[model samples]
Target chain A: MCSMKVVVCVKQIPDPAGNLRLDQASHNLVREGKLILDESDSYGVEMGLQLAEQAGGGEVTLVSMAPNSETSGLRTALAMGAANAILVSDPALGGTDALGTAKILAAAIKRAEPDLILAATESSDGYTGTVPVQVAELLGLPSVTFSKKVTVAGDKVIVERQTELGYDEVEVGLPALVTVTAGVVEPRYPSFKGIMAAKSKPVEELSVADLGLDTSEVGTAGSRQQVVSVVPAEARSAGEIVTDDGEGFQHILAYLERIKVI
Target chain B: MTLNVIWVVVDRTGDKVATVSLELLSKARQLATTVEAVTWGDPSQIAEVVGAHGAQTMHSVGDLGGGLPGPAVGAAIADQVRSGSSPDAIFIPQTYNGRDIAGRLSARLDRPVLTNIVDVEESGSGLITEHAIFGGTEVLRASFTAAGPGLFVIRAKSFAAEPGTDGAATTDNWNVPDLASTGAAKIISSHVEESEGPKLDEAPVVVSGGRGLGDAASYQLIENVAKLLKGAAGASRAIVDAGWVPYSHQVGQTGKTVKPTVYIACGISGATQHMVGMKNSKNIIAINKDQEAPIFSIADLGIVGDVKKVLPQLIEALEKRN
Candidate 1:
């Protein structure tokens, strides 16, 4: 019914479709490749845009913690109609874990003074699935994760929180955080005109220092865990692959018998 | 390194403790000299089960008063650590509440959390955790470089849960601190989807369908095969996102992690996200129209066929055999 300032936590990750290379030294995904808006974050962007639109006023701002000052991903979201973006990029943020990332995002999000904060339940690449809640805890705000559906009513937000059994109707006062599940909404593709206009969208770049975070509080130095070893998981040996020869079910039946499940 | 004390976060609904909690307790017992358990509800309800799993002590924050348990419960545990009973590591099952509590605790303590753990061990007084990445293709072993009480959020079925002769755990009450605004979120109501047969994660056999099942009505084929097999029905995120099924049936990253004895994936083009959840199944069978679907890479038997045709034939054959 009024202005709804929603801040969406977006992640600029290496494209999943492309070859992924792990950094030999850091044991993290190599950032040398081009970065794109993580597909999971698009759902949150779309959800934020819709919520702001339904309220008839206000704007959606994007907050991201990325390497190499990646604005390419932010531009895509901005083109899709986010008003502006805040990017926290610093060499010191190379190996930030979920909690460390949360601290940085929470700092930037506070600057936006949003009524609601939205993020994907987890990033497509990292899949840590804990940042939004950690950010909420850091900001002293209540959080609801895995929201399949969200509604804003006055100063409170009602969410259909996805759970193991089904879903729970969760209600939290505004100025809270909610992590949207993937496919909660279809993200709109940037129109040609929108894309052209996005070139001028404001993307404010900041560093760890800008956020007043000490170097030892944000990155590899601040990371509590270190990769001890990396090894290939034991691969499942390939088995027989057959085209249906009108008796495919027989093979399944025989296999079941061999396994003695039938 | 042998840990002096390890704590397992027990998740329960009424009297039934989550299998993952017992699994963690078992693993914790092996790694530490002492294993403890914590929960949000009455510690007595799960005390015997947790004790049998090797938890020597149980802690509870009592009822959450309709509030989400994360903030209050997390703070309670943090208070215990601040007051002196600091465990070497805290093992949390990778469930909805587990992640929330772990995240809250990590934030409150200014520590980092290692999640998606598939295996954990103690080496030189610290804990090492293994995580499957890129759809279980690679495993990364990590260890906390910081201080005590390393928080680990582990996946289900990562370890065998065996019961000891221990009868009951010594119980203690943990204080729920003033949560301020963090405890304002409340579960106003809840719904549990009506499911028959075994739960998807607990079933010995699981039959899953994806978008290739055509329409919402075709999902019945998945349920039919699962029923005839005395298994559980699951779905890929694509169909669940398409609103064809409830989220309870989704088997994938961001969904349920299931390690059934046999997993039959029908009409599902295996994405890494989907595979992450079910790849650990003892045996995998994928039937997809596309031979190139990644599901075949791990499937013990790959059948390239239309699920519409193959499912009916399989269902009929199963019925006749029964």
Candidate 2:
């Protein structure tokens, strides 16, 4: 693998489907004081770090799209093992849906000019599994996602892609974009040595305008998919457990028969 | 007036293919007055398959659908829409690769994507697509903007494969689509992994065990029942945390929300998280020693005896049936 530059896109979302407490009035997920790496994004982060480590010379820069106040996770990435970090934050970037998110990422990728860009296939919140593909479209670059294993040698990039029943092996040229699945690699726990090393890495902060993005082209205003409303699902009632082995066995069989599982 | 439905044919694994594309021919024979079925790759052979499916003609995007390569296929589809060959409704399989292509095409054309759909209904001039969210607990109703192009992803085994048995297959050579030049980012190597068994989301039966299974050996009853039923196996968060089962099979908010047709709970206390995963199942059967265990309320069938005892009898009955 060559020492090609790599950029990792990280998002700090509320834990996957955590009791997303909403403000009573605004109906926004109350996440001012809490955030973690979007569970799905871990795959992308781990993949990017693996690439850089394999190359042995180029660095992996952790870049995040979030409000300026929510930049700690990006720093945490630095603390983990990122060679450097950057925060692309601004009020204008708020409430960007997946497409808006992709547009923002495209601008960020262009600004970084990295040879490779990696991201999670989806954000657990949206579960659309569309951002990386959308980002590829917005950037007009060749991007294939759900890649399980990635190897780079010379000008070619080889990836093990997750398919419906099995996997397929495909090789493409360099400087492309890919989104990874969980099997990419296990993320390393940050040690004291890595945490201290991260402290010395440079972090560049950029606002929305600094990237030369058309603010109108990215954000809630640019998105077509709107969240009409999110209601808490009804609570399931306590279940019944029958103890009579004879009757219970019959009941279980009857239940399965009713559902046509038999 | 009826709307155009362009059914995108896919292979068994959900990957796009020419043979499966022809299956659309059988349905097209019914709806082709306004509906069109398109086979996206192999200009000559796929078009014949599409014709058999009832397409008056095929729309070919150069180097897509089969052996065309993933990224190129994606851009070619986008180029077709950009060139005004937009579909009123598009159908693709809900496989991993299919969704990636669907996601890309949706983004490139700036279309709203409703993914992993199970069924579609028409409402006046607009169409409604039904989607299952959070595994299956929530069913979302969506209608495309008036006469908007709708994308439908069909689950394998949900729709029966129809061959071109009823219609004569027609053939055409569609001119390849021209891809718009984009910034060139070189390709990388790719690999594929093969996964089998009933997928967690679509399995018909799921047998889940909890901490009451005692230890490793106690967990065997759950597996035996699952095997007898030809079903997927799952575990509660408690059992998973105890190292009784791999976390992949954990049924909870943090794990998988499965909508199997039948869910059998063994020794589970019915924690809220576990309930969230199996509550949407069509029929729930709970087996726990405690007669008042929380899992019984929602269960269609309740067995208050030990799962170890109950499961063997059930399996024996199944064996007798076979």
Candidate 3:
């Protein structure tokens, strides 16, 4: 039986279904509301768990960086069968950008010492889509992003990375980072028994200092960029509305002709 | 201009420069006195187009063979920066390889990258990037508080591609620096999926479907309508997530942003994420049974009807007209 230890990076985000509020002072999405497992990260967690199960006697560890030492999202991943979790939370990490976040995750991930790392291509909230690769570079490891399908042999990870035209088959050795695209695997819901067990699973919490990172290199002070201002975008005005009445085609045709697209 | 020089990382297929790259070059010209290009492939073939788009020089990282270009290209640029030759800011299109290269460069240089940017402007104080949030309802403007060489990853079609009076760009080749372990990932093989008609993002007209179309089988109606109009077929994130269509066909924040002359969203309820990508289309036409669908908010013309019935009539009518 193949034994592969995988570390999955998860993010706790404001529920997409609920109203989203930005922190006025920082211009960051306010996470004061009870944060939940970002829907995007669930796919990575599920993929990691599946890969571990396929490898027989292996474990999938969770790594997250959030404020208020958020463990609610970690519990969900644990309930989905992650063995343990590492949480890196500190007030100093408030204004961290993609690069700072990557530094924190890379440091926390090193403690897991896994054979592979999995993360969503982009988080639902920030959506910079650069953190995973940044983590890979900070750790000095190879990475493949936008992976739709992933498999592991004895010492190599094979990924089918999504591209504009199609997909590319990529191969890298063990201890590599991979960013999974959404819908790669259907994430399973947490079962009652699994949920109960997750409450007792070990959750190791670390601070910015705990991860051997200096405050000068993280948070608002450490950030190389900042939000200057935010303004409402110019709204697109709505035009004509009509019931189909078996005549909707005529309107579309008229618009097409007016635009000279025909 | 606020910035002295700016570099646009060109993404290309063979000799043809990607439209987004030209768009960035055009914007870069407006932001800086000098605009240059950095690309992975040989620059000799694409110098003309990039130059016409306002790039004065094309910096090539040489051919990467089958290996991924992220590590090599990023490393090469970092080396240049360290050697005292770097642009004030770099503009990279938010493509698969583009993000990878930007990420590597950010990590290597310990800089931050602003991504998902839909607009960029000079704020006098510095460069500001505008991001469309909440489905383009709000714009968040951000800038680099630190000094030198800011990295920006912009979405496709964020800026128009306009050719300047420049001729062919002078080409400069940079050797791919040794990447060691960082260059381990290699492309073993690539499969290009079969696509029909005009490319989705470049099509003058786009026809997209959502979950309201019922099942995977019903998606063909979107394709048929697109073909009838000589356009391209697209899908909302809902349908793509439901496995009704491939992710390539998805149009949303996490998908390809298309600013076609006309966008036809059929049976889509207009999720915020979906609208962020296509809401900027010159003309939007939404067809959904639910009249209150958020898609109607930005639609130039809204049809409250069942796509199952409406799409067929539309298809038949278009065919008769042709």
DockQ of each: 0.77, 0.34, 0.80
Q: Could you arrange the candidates by TM-score from highest to lowest?
A: 1, 3, 2
What are the runs in model 1 whose C-alpha is more than 4 Å off? none
lDDT of 2 by residue, B1-322 (tens): 3565554634333333533234333433443354444334445544444444556655444434333233454555566666787766676655555666666676766766665454455567555666444434455555554244665554433333465533433433344444343223333322333324565655788888887677868787887788788887889867764556654576755456677778888889786557756787777888888876767777777777877677778778888987
How far residue B92's Cα lies from its native spot in candidate 1, in Å, is 0.8
Q: RMSD to native for every prediction?
A: 1.4, 5.7, 1.5
Instruction: Kindly list the interface RMSD, in angstroms, of each predicted candidate in the order they appear.
Output: 1.2, 5.7, 1.2
The order by descending lDDT is 3, 1, 2
Better of 1 and 3 by DockQ: 3
Indicate the DockQ of the complex predicted as candidate 2.
0.34
> How many backbone collisions does model 2 have?
39
lDDT of 3 by residue, B10-126 (tens): 997535788899999999998899998999777888889899999999899987877787898899999998889988999999998899999999999988899999889888857
lDDT of 3 at B97: 89
Off by over 4 Å in 3: none
User: What order do candidates take by DockQ, descending?
Assistant: 3, 1, 2
Candidate 2 structure, TM-score to reference: 0.75
Evaluate residue B113 in candidate 3 and report its C-alpha lDDT on the 0 to 100 scale: 91
Stretches of candidate 2 off by over 4 Å are: A21-30, A193-202, A227-239, A242-262, B1-33, B41-70, B116-125, B128-223, B232-261, B265-281, B286-322
